[model samples]
Target: MAARTAPAQPAPAQPAPIASAVRRDTADAARWPDVARLPAAQPVRTAIARHLVGRALHRLSLLEPDGAPAGATAGPVLTLHDPQAFYLRIARHGLTGFGESYMAGEWDSNDLPGALTVLAAHADTLVPAPLRRLRPLWAAARPGQDRNTPQGARRNIHRHYDLSNDLFAAFLDPTLTYSSALFTAFPARFDSLAQAQHRKIDRLLDLARVEEGTRLLEIGTGWGELALRAAARGATVTTVTLSAEQADLARNRIRAAGLADRVEVQLRDYREVRGRYDAVVSVEMIEAVGCEYWPDYFTALRRALAPGGRIALQAITMGHQQMLNTASTHTFISKYIFPGGLIPSRRAITEHADAAGLRTTADDGYAEHYAETLRLWRQRFTTNKDAVTALGFDPVFQRMWEFYLAYCEAGFRSRYLDVRQLLLTEGTRR
Candidate 1:
């Protein structure tokens, strides 16, 4: 997860043309757009919406309060405010419109996770059969500027991760982990978030076979937690990150932990890394590599491995067919939260790593753990709204972040998305 920054400081008065251009860029790049003034729906549109929502919920085994299962408590289900407009928007813009409608408060549910779980389970069947083929016309095109070129990567990363670190600290546990955490056996209390995060990092380290005197390279350094842990295991850790805030804080943390000599924190891109190591671990970093550059990213990791070295990767993934369907489309999460990021499929990883001469040694899925992790983060964030606002985030930004967290949580809960820890060795070595 990258940091999300608001305008750093107010600008001095500027020339009219220059001011206009700046405003255009900021507005065009915004993930939240104006929807409060959506056009009124026609009578025919309302009729179509009633039928569509009724049939869809029925198929999903969910019941609206208007039609709750007899004698059964009203379980989670969609509750529409402006039914006509909500349906019309989905009919027009497909998935993008569905998300925006949520932002606009056109519909709401007290049981968001449960409601979304149902929707996620029936994602492919949401649209009518006849209208499905028209999906190409409704899906948003991926923006060219969102590509992960060196220059573009810097801009996108800065937009989120270069924001105030204090803002992120407000919600995350003391470990400063921003990725999926491996929780203890299910049905546990929320107090175990930090412990779960440590367990997750340790598992990755073990998977990579990091041991005493090992040279370990970590591609994404999220505040240096992993680096610190590796150094404590007698491993020399070299960790790289594009976030200036993260690097500065991570270095301070390392030095404070008295492990600076064993850990090297660098402000560099993954493509620029050059050394070989006994173990390499990248956590949730592949999503940011962009689909187009996956080959190069994996190739770089392969080249950076010494003889018999193993690479451990923790990645967020989707089903292969879903990945194929969304590969060319833009999503609200990308627009607002993680620009240029795309969750890969396990199949995609297998194929790409094979092409890079890396053979998979192990693959483990922990999608349920991610759901628990997000649920905890969302709770912490919601409880600390004042702290977030103190960091200069507005109401809209807050809502966007909440939605992003809940959206991801639902994906995992429904088994529509997953997080995996993968171990890979050079094809010849294995």
Candidate 2:
């Protein structure tokens, strides 16, 4: 036996063709990176991306969907449903793609606010050092037609506020106040939203020193709710708005409330508003005034304000750095929800006001209240989803609305954004 020739090893069992196919499939599945799209960019960029995201998450102690971070007390849990697609989109479009990914349902969170808080905490670090230099190239410019010109203002307001009264009513409280509610009661009940809204209005009126014989000018008559409230205080009120639908309904509501004698609603632009007033109050309206037109808006308001009168403005604001970074960018919110809208930072407000010969006398931030208010609105909208669809809004539109509410809620929750009641007087007051 020639050294006992090794028994012909049975041709090592050739994997069955079907088995080979199954094995190949398993290998292909395993080849997908734990985080998708990680290799979409240059090696350096890819490493930077991974490091930035990983470091931020770990710092926040936020868990990945299957309970990550081994022993850390986790915050929000992020689920990357299609990590590859999500990362690829982010690589291509940057921040806008981040929003697009959410819209596309490529990612999700167990607690949206918690997730946003984590992001907010690390906002400065989220953009890798190398990519930070390219932000200008990545950002989309504000559209020319999306200006807050008298014509553009009308177009933008009509796009959102003119959708339909019934549609808004389905979600808003009966007061029809579209701005942030005061929500004196934390964890507010549905019924409390109206009371809270009224409280918010009254507080502004009080701040403006509205009283009997006062001449009140309101910019942005939101369905006439604020005007009605002001008029009820015995002040003669003149309110203006660019939305035809809001004007029509607001006028009717004024008549129905039997306060038409005290209040006048006009479909007019702030730039065209002409009367002087003892008090001026604009609630959540200044956000529509593009950064370029803020000076004009404040000048007009200043012109309309009488000697010794005060202006009470309810505004939504973001971090100063965020405002600076985003001022020139046309964002998802501006594109879909409010075509020409730009939320002013407190710094922008004060600067513009000072430029217009006004000074901020008092400022109060109620960002947490706004978060609760949005939660209530979102709840109502979800409850009335069927009614919303019946009003001719398609699924995408509804989802967009839902996302809008949730996004704002998250912003406020994270303290990355806020709503403030600001009291302003002539610069001489300072």
Best by TM-score: 1
Off by over 4 Å in 2: 1-75, 189-191
TM-score of 1: 0.87
For candidate 1, lDDT tens digit of each residue in 92-189? Answer: 55556676666666666656666677788788887687766766776788899999998888888888888888888977999999998886555335
Cα lDDT of model 2 by residue, 37-68, tens digit: 23245555445545666556656666453444
- List ranges where model 1 is wrong by over 4 Å: 1-31, 36-54, 58-73, 428-430
Model 2 gets an lDDT of 0.75
Q: Given candidate 2, what's the lDDT at residue 115?
A: 65
What TM-scores do the predictions have?
Answer: 0.87, 0.83
Check candidate 2 and list the clashing pairs: 36-84
